[model samples]
Structures are given as C-alpha cells and as structure tokens.
Target chain A: MPELTARAAPPLAHHFVDMRQQTEAARLGMWLFLASEVLLFTGLFTAYSIYRYLYAGVFEEASRKGVELWAGTTNTFVLITSSLTVALAIHFARLGRGKLAAALLGVSLLLGCAFLGIKAIEYANHFHEGQLPGKFYTFAEVQGPGASMFFTLYFIMTGLHGLHVIAGMTVLAVMAVRAWREEFGPEHYAPIEIAGLYWHLVDLIWIFLYPLLYLI
Target chain B: MPNGEHQTALEPHHGAGRYVAVWVALCALTVGTLLASRLSLGPPWHLLVALAIAAAKAGLVALFFMHLWDQPGVNRLVFATSLVFVALLIGLVLLDSATRFPLANPPNERTLRFEPPSFETHVQPGEREQGEPGAIGRPPARE
Candidate 1:
C-alpha cells in the first residue's frame, strides 16, 4: 500500500518483489503459455508428417489442386507484415509513445483482417472447386487414395490457423483500444508486448504452413 | 525508495529501425523459400531446404520480434524445450517409419485390408444370424 512517485514505476502486486521480478514472471508465464500452444500445434504437424510420408504423391498433387499459390503467398506476406507492425507497436509502447503504438497496432489489425479475407477467398475457391475435407471432398483433379486425407489435413490445419488469426485480431483490437486510451507507457506496457508475442506466434505458424500446404 | 520494492527499467533501447530491418529480412526469406520450392531439388532435399528456411524465419521472429534475445534464460529454456519435444515427436515417428518394412509402416492400413471383403459371405440371404460376428474375416461367436 505504498504510494509510488508518478515517474517511478507501476504499482507492483503484493506478491512481487519488484517491477523487474513481476515483469519477468509474467513474461515467463507467457512463454510457458506459448510453449503449450506450440505443443498443441505439434499434434497436427505430426499428423501432417505421417500422412505426407504415407501418401507423398497424393499429398503433393492435393497441395497443387486444393491450394492456390498466389493466395497463400499473399496471406504469408500479409501475416509477416502484421508481425512487423505488432513488433513495432510493442517497440513504441515501450517508448511511451501511446499514439504511435496504437497506430501501428491498428495497422497490424487491418493486416490480420486482410489475411483472413484472403483465406476466406481461398476457402470459397475450394468450395467452388469441390475441394473439401474427408467424404465431402468432390474435387476431381486429385482423386484417389489419400486424396481426401490431404484435403482433410489441409482444412484442419489451416482452419485451426485461421481461427487463431481471428483470435489474434480480437486481442489486437482490445490492445489497440487500450493503447489509444494511453493506458500503456514506458513503465508499464507489458500487456502490449505479451499480445505482440501472441500475434507473432500466429505469424510464425503461418510461415511454415505456407510452404507445407502450398509449395511442398 | 518505495516500500522496499525493486524497480526494473521497463524501457529498452527503442529502435524502430531494427524492427523494420527484421521485417525486411523475413519478407526476403519468404520469397527465398518460395523460389527454393520451385527448384527441382527433388524428394528429401527439397523438403529439408524448405523446412530449414522456415526454421530460420521462425527463429528470427522469435528472437528479434518476440524479444527472446532480451528475455531471461528461463523463458528461452521453456521455448527451446517446446521445440525439442516437437523434434522428438517427429524424429521418433520418422525413425520408426524408416526402420520398419515398407508394408509394415504404422500408417499403412491398406496392408491390413489388401483384399476386398465379400459382403454377401458375411450375411447369408434370408438367414437371421443372432449373436454371430457380422463382419467378414472375423472370428465366430464364442458361446
């Protein structure tokens, strides 16, 4: 219940020894959370590797038929750009430049939306071409053994990623609102940084996904 | 100072330029991976190269953008542990596949059902089978 000077530091929780300890603890918790997230995605990646190994030819052909190169690449750029903006937002938030941070966050949110928009377009294309998962798949270009399995894996992996994008966008929106309200500053912008970490993870997942689903 | 509370400097060197530079590198790498995929590296090498580029890109984002470089050792360890486990999962499965007979691979279910089963043989016409196994190639009821 000690009164802190205006320029000193944010009020630390009762259990924390110092702002440094508290921040580190919070950050470590976030990293652990991220680690768990990585583990969750690992299951899908394992499924992908096993299926790809078993049905190499069918998977490769399905990649070509089910996914559009231009759309996937465009979304990749969009997501990577969003990661940069989020990183910059965190950078500015640490400098106590709330407006700049908010602006950059806004940009990142737009790019996130744009990525989803492109994904939706790709999904629509899949629907039109009858390239669906499992038994619903009707695409004739790549039919036969393991064909449905490829689309099944494709829809599951990317669909999960798309959901993450939506979640990231929602988080960015909340952060953007807070940043615009000047809630973050040099002494206390850990939330912004943590959210940026999350957004970057989303981008990171897509970076690998682009090549795996679209290219190889 | 204030109630024996330790204060850490929250402000690091704010370099927008570094972020911009990293962003450029990431984009260039994306394009590079795309170009590499277009090459006829063939089979394992093609996959290996593409994955290497992805790992590099993921590292750049994690170390630079996610501030893992500045993060404490504990956080880094936690992250690295996650990656190691992923490697373990993939590596062990791949090793099993590589070592196993081609037809004996765990995922190769076709070997179990290589021949199409006759449906008519499982259930006779106008014969109401009670408590008997329904599927073909299955053991008879043990009454």
Candidate 2:
C-alpha cells in the first residue's frame, strides 16, 4: 500500500505529491535508510565495544600498536569540513544563487576526495604493516590477535564509511554541475539540501565511529 | 515534494549567514569532539559523548545547511524512524554481547579445552607432536 502510494507520485514516485513532495520524501527516505545503515554498522560497533570493554588494554594496545591514530584523526577533520561545505551549499541554494551553491558543493566534493585519498594512505599503511584481518594480521609489536579485532572492526567500519564518502562525493559533484546550470533555486533546491543531509549523516556516523575506532 | 497536506510555500530555509554559521558550528563541534577524544571518558561514555557532540554538529548541518527545518514536517518523522530503528538494532545487538559476558569467563591461559578457542594461536605442529605444552594454544577469551 505504501509502495502504491509512493509510486503514485507524479510519474516520479508513489510517495510524493509534487516535486517538492518527491524531494522531501526522498530526503526523508534517505535518512531512514541511513538510520538502518547506522544500526547495521552498530552490530560491528557493538562487537568492538563489548570486546574493548572486556579487554580495554587489548583495545588500547591495538589502537597504539596497529591503528593509524594520526591518519584517523586527520580524516575526522576532513569529513567534518566536507560536511560544512555541503551544508553551506544548501544554504547558498536556498538564497537562489545556484552558481555559488554549486561552487560550495564543488569544494565539498573536493574535500570528500581528499578524505578518500587520505583514507587510502591510511589503508595502505595498515596493509603495509599487515593489519589486514582475522588471523592474517601481523602487528609485530602487539601481544596477539586479540587486540587485532579492534583493527579489524576499525578497517571494516571506516572502509564502509570511505565507500560512503566516495558515494557522497559523486552525488555532490553531479548536483554541483546541475546546480551551476541553475537547476535549483528557492523552489527547486531540494537536491542540494538532500545531498547536504546525506553528507551530514555520513559525518554523524563517523562522529561515533571516530571515537570508537580512534579514541576509545 | 509537492503534496497537499496543509499546503505550504517552498520558501528557502537558509540564508548566506545561516550557511556560514552552520559551517562554523560544525567546525567547532568537530574540534570539540577531537579534543574530547583526548579525554578518557571511559567505555561507552567515550562513544556517547562523541556521538552527542556529533549529533549536535549534524543538527546544525541538517537544520541550517540542509534546510530540512523548512522542507516538510513529515521529514522529521522519517528522521525519527531511522534513528529509532538504528537504536533498536544497536540496543538488541549490544544486549546480546553484554549479557553473554557475565554468564561465562574465559579460560585463563589460552587453552583449547572446550569450544574452539576464540583468541589467536601460535601453532607449532612439530612441537605439539612432541607433546610441547605451548604447542597450538591460546588464552580462553570467548564468552
């Protein structure tokens, strides 16, 4: 029934009444999907949390011995800044200045790329150090693989997040181009706003992940 | 999206200053969390505090930057649902992990007695064949 209604949207979707409805519905849906995603990763986070709770020293040792604390911290900064760009982009869109909006989005896209590039370096360092996964880890300084699970989760969560960063970059880039052509304004700025929401959610997820994987 | 739920104008939700403000706030919050990470808030609190701060930052982004504040009232419901479900999944999973611990203790010296030992193992098959005590072993760490 919901699908029917969502499909009923004007040749666009069933859930919306107009383009505004479509945009809002889609944005809301994205957030909802993200919520599910948050939970999905929560499983891995929960595992990491429990083990770290029980073996605080192991988790701490793993962070120090295996994880790239510096790189993780740097990526944290990059993500937040990218989020700022997207947010500002939305603001520019609201002001009916498509060109400036697009420019801000471009900045966001660039920062997002920078984040992935930095992440690649972090992953490369991890790989070079043989912090792969499971029994394959080779942290020469660590006690054993017990602490490596932290790294394992660290990689998985951050890797998944990196993928999202890439995805958000693509979305922002496309929207930036469209926005530059004046496809959005006060009445048609939903895409820019939606993109901002998604980007922020990505940042939000990482906010929790950063402390878990890097700090605590 | 255009619908007739109480019909409203698609007026813009943010201004240039608002955009800048959200960005500034986001930066401040990110720096705050980074600094907060330096603090040893203890187990869940570390995650909790970081997330709380992140949420505040994200709220600034969402409300000001994304202009979700003016989009539609229903969108908030969507956000709520997503958050609730995510929380549920986290709650359920953590409940399982947390409850399992008190019911059992890991065997002290990485042993392979009962279940498949959960920790890492350094296996020396030759030494094990020679009845070496350290051959193929681990600390009992799984709950």
Candidate 3:
C-alpha cells in the first residue's frame, strides 16, 4: 500500500511524510554539501592569504603586471549574469514555466562557456609570457623570491575555480535537459533549485577570487 | 492528488523581478569594486575595500539567488557555520604568520635580517670558525 502511494505521488520519497518534508530535506542536504564545498575552497583561500601577507609587494606587482585585469573583470560579469539566469530559471521552474526555465538555463550555459573561453585566452597569454607556476615560472619581469609564489597561487586558485565552473556547467546542462522534459514543476523542482544553489556557489567563489587574484 | 496543502509549503514563490533587481545590484557592485581597485589606497585599505565589495556581492547571491533568505534556519545555519570556520582558518593562520619572529619566515628580501645561507657561497670547510655565533645558516642580529 505504501509503495502504491509512493508510486501515485512521484515527487515525495517513501520516507518523507509529505512533499514539504521531502523538499526541505533535499534543500538541507544540498546546503550541507555546499558548506563542505565552502570549506574546501577555504583551505586554498587561507594559503593565498598567508602568501599575500608574506609577500605583499611581489603579489601586488604580479597581479598588476602578470594578471589580465580585463579578462578577470569580463569573466566576473559573465558569471554574475549566468547566476542571474540560473536564479531566474529556478523562479520560472517554480511557476511551472518549463520551456522558459530551460531556455534560461541554456543562456546561463552559454555564459559559463564564455567565462571559460576568456579564461583560456588568459591562460594562453600567461603560457606565452612564461608566467607559469612554481619552477616552471620563467617570467623575467616579475622574478623575485615571492614572485613565482604569486603565480603559483594564482594558477592553483583560479585553476581549481575553473574546474568548479566546468562542474557547474555540467550540472546546469543536465538541469536544462530535465526542465525541457517538464520534469520540474511547482510540485517538484527541488533538482533545479539545488543545481541553482551550486551554480550560485560557483559564482560566489569567483566573486572573491576575482578581487583576491586579479584586482588586488 | 490532494496535495494542495503541501504545495504551499514546498518553496516560496519568488517573482522574476526580485532576481533581476539582485542581478542589477551585483553588476553594480562588480563595477564599483573594479573602480575601487584602481585607487591608490595602498596597503590593507585596498584589500579591505575590495573584500567588502566582494562580500556584498556574495551576500546578494547567497541570500537571494541561492534562496537562503527563504530557506529554513538549519540551511542558513549550516552555510553560516562553514563561513565561520573559513574565517577561523584564515584568521588563525594569518595571525600566526604575522606574529612570528622576523627571521623565522623563509629567507626573502623582505624578511628582516634575511641573510643568505653561507653554504650557497661554497665556503671552504676551514674558512669560518666552527662555533661562530653568526656563521653558516645563522640569522643576523636584529638592528
């Protein structure tokens, strides 16, 4: 009888007493996962802080000379716009506008791709200029004790963030497909909401990364 | 399909306008931070201003975009706790490094009394006294 009832109401899990409990549990679980993700990045942020403190001059010099401020700023705008789209996607999903939600997700996906494209160009410039990390760093202009460390942290922090961007893009792609299939509606849109949370988190991390790495 | 009661509890319905407004604010903050970075504030002020702007941007994303504002307290608490730990990790590490003895830091041009190890110069074994106070890998006295 419970199995039959669970089959009748597809959105509510067997353990959940109702849709409310189910959605709340899913949201709580997602938040817990996001919290863990925050901690993961926090480690790298701590490393950045320590190095920046120890070598303030070289870090600023490297940021000013080696980093492409325009590229970083452009990516920041791209991601903020993507985050808006994803949030709008969630809003539309809850309103049972599946097609519009899917389209918005598509737009967000393109924005994410644009961010990666800009990042690639920046990476190419860095490679050509010998602004590599660690021992591979041979950029003559910023050479010093802490100069390479600046690039080292730069590559590590931004590289990890790039991976997160890829992950967020993959999740958004899946959500878009699901939404297009009308899998998400007012009765059941936890997946889209959860995915939006992840995407927003990616944007949040980059918000800090842009300033800490590229700007100052 | 008498789940009408549950429908109201699923998630709060937010208008598209609210999100658009947040987006606009985010973009404005981004531009503001970019402009702030150009100023010659120097030292920690530049970093503080940049971080403050970034925090505002992040808050908008987390609260509105991520729906933390409508979320249950547990979810908000979970995220806030993680942020607290992040502050702790960064704060403690920075405090440790900032307060360490000058010569305790790695040998760098900026480090006070930072002297290159004598071994790098390939000093002959008998060239320096065996137990000299400031010889071979010893940090010079602070001025």
Evaluate every candidate with DockQ and list the scores: 0.35, 0.26, 0.45
lDDT (10s digit) by residue, model 1, range A64-174 = 767899999999899989999899888777656667889999999889888888889988998898888877888988877788888888899999999999888999999
Candidate of highest lDDT: 3
Note the residue pairs that clash in candidate 3. none
TM-score of 2: 0.75
- Go through the candidates in order and give each one's C-alpha lDDT: 0.82, 0.68, 0.86
Model 2 CAPRI rating: acceptable
**Which pairs of residues have clashing backbones in candidate 1?**
none
Which sections of candidate 1 miss by over 4 Å? A1-9, B1-7, B105-143
Please write out the lDDT profile of model 2 over residues A1-216, one tens digit for every residue: 122132322234555667666666667677677667766776776767556655666777677567677777788778777777776776666555668878888888887888888888888888898787788777777754365676778878888888888887888888999777666644456667667777877887776777667765
Per-residue CA lDDT of model 1 for B1-143, tens digit only, reads 12224345643554689889888999999899999988969789888898999999999999899988776579899999999999999889877776775556644445444565455555644454654444444676699
List where candidate 2 sits over 4 angstroms from the true fold. A1-19, B1-8, B41-48, B101-143
Whose lDDT is higher: candidate 2's or candidate 3's? Answer: 3
* Residues A1-216, model 3: lDDT tens digits: 122223224466688887777888899999999999999999999998888888888889999999999999999999999999999998777666777899999999999999999999999999999998888889998978788998888888889999999999999999999887767656688899899999999999999999998889
The worst-scoring run of ten residues by lDDT in candidate 1 chain A lies at A1-10
